[model samples]
Target: YTSALHFLNTKIGKGQIFLKFDTVEHDAEKRLLAYVYMKNKTFINAHLLKHGLAQVDTTYPCKHLAKFTNLWKAARTNRNDAEKE
Candidate 1:
């Protein structure tokens, strides 16, 4: 969580941020869950997954589920390989 927060901080002021909503806009408690993108079209969700800083939540279906799951798998594999070294 801290790592994700720090990385997001670095993105601050780089450009305008945009949110991409899926089927559900928010959870039961009114917390938002959306894909964040930068003005230049940088995908923050994939970035976090690629860096092993975020986990893929498969509880709900989303458009990027397959892509996110793939990225998360690759990141986990990379981390495991690095640890084996």
Candidate 2:
């Protein structure tokens, strides 16, 4: 969690960010769940998944859920392969 927070802080440091909300605005806990994007058009969500800093949540359907899931799977595979080396 600390690593993820640090990664996010570095990515979001003093830079303009954007959020895109899906059909729904908030989650069950009233937390604002949206797709985060960096100024240079970098998809933060995908990056987090690719780096194994975050897990893909499929509970709520979203356009990028599939892509995020694939990235997460690839990250896991890469990590496992590295561990076997």
Candidate 3:
């Protein structure tokens, strides 16, 4: 987990990040659904999902929920196929 975080931080660099909050509450335990955009060019969340580094939380409501689900499923399928070989 630490290594993953480090890798993410490196990728983020000093670029501007935009966070779209899904909720108003600032509780630490609550997971806020937000898409992290870097320099208005990359969708960080989708990249993470596609690389199998993140999982889709179906309980949350988001505009990109379906896209995230599909990316997750494809990543899992690819991983499974690779393992079988």
- Against the true structure, what is each candidate's TM-score? 0.90, 0.94, 0.78
- In the range 6-84, model 2's lDDT, one tens digit per residue, is 9998888888999999887788999988999998999999999999999988778788877988999999999999999
Off by over 4 Å in 2: none
lDDT per residue for candidate 3 within 1-85, as digits (tens), equals 6655775888897778888665442335765657788886688888888888888876655778889999999999999999999
In candidate 1, stretches whose alpha carbon ends up further than 4 angstroms from where it belongs are none
Backbone clashes, each candidate: 0, 0, 0
TM-score (C-alpha, index-matched) for candidate 2: 0.94
The true-versus-predicted C-alpha distance at residue 52 of model 1, in Å, is: 0.4
lDDT of 1 by residue, 1-85 (tens): 9888888888654568999999988877899999999988999999999999999987666999999999999999999999999
Considering only N, C-alpha and C atoms within 3 Å, which residue pairs clash in candidate 2? Answer: none
- In angstroms, the error of model 1 at 31 is 1.1
